[model samples]
Target chain A: MADPAANGNTDSGGSRIGRVPAGYWLAGAFLLVVPSFASNFVMYQIFGWSFILGMISLSLMFLAGYGGMFSLAQMTVAGLAGYVVAICGTSAITDISQNWPWYINIPAALLIAAIFATIVGWLAVRTEGIYTIMITLAVASAFFYFTRQNYVLFNGFSGFNGIFPPQLFGVDWRNPIAFYYLALFWAVFWYLAVLYVSRSPMGLALQGIRDNPRRMAALGFDVTLHRVAAYTFAAFPAAIGGILLTWQSAQISPGTAGIGPVIDILVIAVIGGLRHPIGPFVGAFVYVILKSFSIDILVALGMAGERFQLLIGLGFLAIVFWSPDGLLGLWAKLRDLNRRDPLIGRLVRRL
Target chain B: MKTRTLLAVLAATFLTATAHAQTLKVGALATLEGTYTALGEDGMRGLRLALSQANNMAGGREIEIIVAGTDASPDSAVRAARKVVEQDGVELLIGPLSGSEGIALRDYSKTQPHVTFINGISGAQETTFVDPSENFFRFNMDGAQWSAGLGEYIYNVKGYETIATIAEDYSFTYTQVLGLALGYCAAGGEITERIWVPLGTKDFASIIAALPDDVDALYLGLGGGDAVNFLNQYQQAGGDAQLVGGTIMVDGTVLSSKGDAKNALIGVPSSGPQADTWDDPNWQAFVKAYQDEFPPDQRFPSPSLMATGYYNATTAAVSCLNEVGGDLSDGQAAFRSCLSNLVLDAPNGEIKLDGNRQAIGTNFISEVVELEDGTLATQLVKIVPNVNQTLGIDPETFAGFGVPGRDVPECKSSY
Candidate 1:
């Protein structure tokens, strides 16, 4: 078993490596450009949502792949951040909130989201595996109810709209394609940054703790501290996602923290294989694209749009039962097998 | 720099083309997904139904309504609107289902001065009575217009002394609930307590449990699914009270899904698409056309946000368009000058735009009752004409949240 405390990074005087898996990056680019070219409408709806969901799923990747923590509340944390944006940053004309200028309000929103996430992490990180899942789920459910009933703050059901994107480059960055690329750039940064961190000493220690908590403790790794730190680190990406969601929707409703959306992050992470960095994001892309189009398909088949949840749930179950390692893991296995089977390839070429 | 210059030139060209277009391009912006998906879909249907009917105008020039549906957020709405106006070059626009999205469009309407925004049933009172922009025209009832008749009846007709209101805590509900309070208090009824719940709240027991008998009636200010949920829970919990609302109650759309809410509440609503369509053969043909396109079950019992309010709003616009010979300036000026002077027939009434751009003429106060056939329905028990008077503030002084006063309206009378 790998030591949870051992960092993936070998300290070679902080040398930057230009090397990356070209095939994987190529595959990703292929996926990104296809939808943008196929239809402008799809670009806005599917592409935009995927990148935001990608950042959200990255939070789960941090916990599961790095810290060996399986968390369900990462999406809830992101949603809480979105609610914070709505409350603090929204202009009075859109939501009930007045323009609480960016300098003061943005920091306050992020700080509050971080503190909220930390408290959630403090509670959930105590348990392991399924128990942790349950606790995280309960926290998500609790937040959902709080936001739903507490009308004065969350605007109750019909959520506040009219959050204009910050005019950084003098453009309403709320435009879907622009927001999607921004989110993509951020997701890439988080991915690379997390990759580097995973190779660092802290990441190694966390991995050690994840593999054998008792052994890591004996080696002075502070197992609980490592778990909590992992959760906190995970929250930063989720919060970034939440902030982006505030941009995408231009308004945050109580539904932002609702049960379905929170659980959706878990499904994405697990379906893409919780074992890898790129897994959750890959799963999110599949989920968002399928979901955006499935409505029309369902309507054609004489099904209600509300049946969307039912379809997604069934798909998730199918993924879990049939392929525990998820689609990415399956692809990797197929590729490895093809590489080894030179005889089979030669036979096929001859035929 | 090149992108900026191109965009500027493109936008300018688009605006110029829009102003000079012979074929009318009407932008339909809405949500075809998520919680209020049905409402958004309905709004879109109204646009299709209206646009198709509108294209059969006197002149042979085709009026093509280009549509755009977003995920029903202010951000998405703005982006979608920009695409419609800038990319598509629509002369006029409609829809964006939610009050919040409509408000965003109202702001955007300022940038494109000549583009007339015929709203799609976003009934925030501020959209008209407060923030009335020259480019924007709200063709349906605001929160106050829909609730005014019922408010007057509950206060004066029924002599209900005290009332409690349960509504979704968004701006639509807030403005709606407040409209009820304003009307009720004006006619001598005191609102004892107000409970604002979220839109998709599955349960209402805790809220219902909190209610006391101090109030004679309860006002349910929710729509479609949430309304059904609230009423079902309220009734099952043994809370026996006369329920009323500024929302759909026993109407076709409400009753079809919520057969359980039968005889449980009095519903006060402005005219809906299917409600009055039973009397019109043309409307029957339209419903037949709709059923031919989509299955009867897939469509709501009545035109909801789309068929009901949005269709009516569009029909009003069509009427105005026809009256002014398809000229936007003439249409808007005619609407603004003497809306009630319009003799155009409609599913609702004469297509009249009041001073505040709200449809004036009649507000229906209906009672929820069970038919012998065991179907739930609202029978129009009352109709209050020119209900725009209930706004209290006169024809002028309609502005935004800031400036005059965005505070909750204060009632001087306790009794």
Candidate 2:
């Protein structure tokens, strides 16, 4: 056996790199060089959208998995950030948008998203179990209606378009290759951050509060504060994803954070397995792929393209029914089953 | 012998290259999901009808159309557009069936100068009015233009001096309301109230209660499900206000809905791109073709405005293609020139683009009438020709009212 310290549990920098599993290293390498081989559509529309969604869903995972809160307002928060960026930055709605610089608008978006999430957390964390879901959903619906109606700031139903990313480094950041890297960077950063925080003291306290609020409170932890702080922490990734999403489409509208997307973010988190940091990304990939290609798939099956929602609904039901903990849980179960059967285990290991 | 063999190979290569270059790819986009699915389907049907009329050939090039769907969101519409453009590599794109989607497509059209984009059914004024794209062409009237003649018709013909307005709180509705308000107010009519409701509001009890009892008529700007819902609820509440409608309020989509509510819509004055019962030979022929093209179960009794918009746009595209002879070379300069200058004798009326590539087209003033078949349809009242985006007002004065909103085009004695 190896010492825990040598395993990089207590090591820093170079040693930590050495301790990373080969699978993670391979994934990292593949993700880094994805733009080299991927088509512009794949890089920009498929993977770029997946990473942005994954990051937002990651926020949901952080809340539900670590804090025992199934908040549907994560997308709403992301949308708020997008709205902030569009309103603060230049957009086609010159009458509405303040037209601030990107550097200013981006940070402002993050700050505003964090503050909004904090408030949502404050209201939501007071409730337990299904009440929290209901509250977040209500918040999401309210924001949708507000944005769709308030033309002064949100520009009503036709929200801000022509809101492109800053041309930093003499490059249009929304260019497929550049956008791919930008999304990848944020997705990986948040994933690693979530992983790190999951093992940290605050994460532990939040988990403890989730599992047993009374006991954690007895143990001298401020339950509400930790929960709200978790929301603040999760908001950063979601806000970044929102900013990227707005840039990707070069637009932001109420539909971006409508009730459909709010539920979709929750569905992505749950379907990917909220049990691990990597689950949301996996789920986001599945969703993005399905969303992008389901029409073709349906058409191939000699079905109408409009039945995509039905297909997605069926897939969601099947995954929820078969794997209560999602794809990751199903994978673990298969691995365990393979371990019990030596022949299958050998085949799996060889593959 | 060697020289003859080389000449044969060169000839074969030339023939194959010519054949390969003779195929034109087109991308058709619509909202096949969410609230506007039916509209998108009709839009596609209209496009297909136009394509079939052209025998799917334009400018000597065989047309290949790829269809994509959106949920009426700008982002999804843009993504779908990108997929068709970047992946399918289409040289032409048509559609995007909602207001915001049109604005988004207009922006996207700027980046893709090579691909010719024709407007689908989206009627937002800003799509072409504000920072209009060079490559994007709209062959259908915007929402404001659709309201041409309705305001005057209401004030002069119906003689309703005081009116209250209720509309879906969106840009399209805002523009439509602005159009009617501008004309009605200028003609010495007064608007008592303008109530703006969110797009998908199910409950109309409160809205019904809020309607001023003194207004001569209630001008409803709601569309699709909202129109049906509001009419249903209003009838249920037993409210007896004389009803006027925005373009979409009295569309076949809502009028044909099976309910006692639509009965209240009878005699309701409205204006739009098409009147279902227009006596014009071209319109009747177009309706016959539309009805024949799709089975009764798959379509409305008459073609909806959405179908008309797409049909007009597709007709323009096909005609322009024939004019340019399928030659998209020189960055499609010739094709675009043909498009800009072409006056399409559309099924609805003559359509020609203005300086900004926006359509200056005809509008139909009509009122709801129950046909002998017990289906609701619009009967023609008047036809307003050459209605521009500015609704015949000076561009400077029109812009001075600012972009359409709740309180925009403030009702006054005259402009």
Candidate 3:
């Protein structure tokens, strides 16, 4: 299949010239206006979660798609940020939080998360392929246990609750519209950042490393450093997402970094199409919608509520089988098929 | 013309009165699809049974239940609660079957000030005792309150002088261990060894090996599949330390799955109500109602502790609603006051919330016994009446007692 990026026909120069595409502007406008039409539930559950989870999975996507590194530690990085936020902010479980101002807490959480990710990435980048996955998984598992058992730090398994989003500008940041816009700003910022990086010279170098790491290393591209950089870059957004997630849920616990959720982010990235910047958000939307409604749907169909996971697994499996690149890849394939047959292509485009 | 005008006014008033009988929306949140699924299902069943008995009417208004799955995480529970409140527009919320979820929901209750939240089997002490919410009420006891008399039961009745404690390393387990240790130590017993296992520790070989041979009993505070794994592994290892602790150790699922291993629990006193063995008419009726709703099948033969907890909470909520005549237009404050003053005739006995909105009710130390049918059952042997959130300790001292842990309560010979 052709590269989705190539089909866009935009170059680094286009981005450098600050020539924003019409579609991009239209999408931005749509997102900005979503708060007006969307209900508070939609804003919180659908958009809020999609943006946060998308940012987390996008980190994974950037690493996997560009650097050829599949780190299971993206959610772990997010969890680290959440823990930092809780520990630095007021919470129900502990008095350990310094109760610092939001300005201090948010940045400190992100910095610590990024540092943690960098250290993990530095250790993990030494390995390749499945070994990279295994090492990251091990790190994730270790973090989960560490947080769960270390009562003085992570407050044991109950974790920290009442970690509210900072009330800023004399407004509660968690209020539906405010929270939505806050999430939107970060999500869009990261999405564009990922897009720009993917087209930059460094991004091209990382992609080269992804395609042929030995060759890139032999050619003096410093492959390990690039991979580590990818991880560090990815951690920033993930950490922000983690902070947002902590604010969204008003709590942080071992479950946030559990093995199940760590894998779910990978699935979301893959299901959305890891090759593209927009894939994670697309996948997150699908996942969040299904997760929110699958139980009710199954119960309505006279099935047990627990079968919701089964349905989700089946859906993921079907998508993977149908198109290795996920839903976006499938869409790309259909579009390619249409282009082959102009008559059908016109009809398809019209539809 | 005067007669026609009078008739029109009467018609308008009658229409307005009929419209006032709106359906009352209530949300039921539980970990309906994860590790604690059995507990969540049992809770839902108990809730539905209570609602059925109430004819689905509360305060002269038809009740509409909106169920959301919590997935047993604090994050998911908060999200589920939000969906139920913001999306489904439920006036009241019940649920979130785990400790962390309870704390999260309590925090969330502050955000939704007008929404009344009744606890659904979440035993985390912090949900009420540590940081109580005015809009939140728990009719069921916290983990510590549930294990009120177990220590005494083990020391005085079971003759366990020095016992070892093995519990899941979490706030809930910590609270459970504290409860057991308090009663045991107060009765002149000792906890010689304390083993805190991480939540998902499947292999108990090392943990079993760590158990001191000198202890009279090994109190087990693990729950669900973890409990099942620990018990099976302990038995397989030929470890014969008498097991006793909290409700989770001898839950219905654990009993049936343990098979011949179930014998080890016989005469071992633990916490929680045992449906099959409780002789109280109210409990029997509740069991009958549950069985009628969910007949004896491959799933459940009798109601579990989760069921009883939800049933009691729902019963309390409905009773309060009945008293208020379904008028919450005055908002959660009116309902909060009503709940504060209300004393519920729960199946276990009278359940009344103390100053902190935590239940002060009967806490049973039930003995594991083989029923006539050869099924394992927990039979209530002792009742600690009016077991409060403070566990009989003064609030200030109890607050300073620190969070339950491997080392807390400073074991003494007497209370």
Chain B TM-score for the candidates in order:
0.79, 0.93, 0.90
lDDT measured at residue B228 in model 1 versus the true structure, 0 to 100: 75
**Candidates sorted on DockQ, descending:** 3, 2, 1
* Alpha-carbon RMSD, each predicted model: 7.1, 7.2, 7.5
Candidate 2: lDDT over CA atoms? 0.86
> Residue by residue across B267-372, what tens digits does model 3's lDDT show?
7778874435778898787777887876576345677788778888888889888888887977756677889988988877788988888888887778778888
What is model 2's native contact fraction?
Answer: 0.44
The lDDT for every candidate, in the order shown, is 0.64, 0.86, 0.81
Candidate 2 lDDT tens digits, A1-351: 011211126645656567676667657766777677667877888779989999999999999998999999999999999999999999877887898998899999999999999999999999998999999999999999889878678888878887889888899898899999999999999988997887789887887898899999999999999999999999999999999999998889898999989989998998888788778987887787677667767977888776777887888889889999887767667655755646554434333
- Supply every candidate's count of residue pairs whose N, Cα or C atoms clash at under 3 angstroms: 20, 1, 2
Q: Could you say which candidate leads in lDDT?
A: 2
Candidate 2 DockQ vs. native: 0.27
DockQ of 3: 0.28
Model 2 docking category: acceptable
Q: Any idea what lDDT model 3 has?
A: 0.81
Better of 1 and 2 by TM-score: 2
Lowest lDDT block of 10, candidate 2 chain B:
B10-19
TM-score list, all predictions? 0.78, 0.92, 0.92
The residue pairs in collision within model 3 are B59-B326, B151-B184
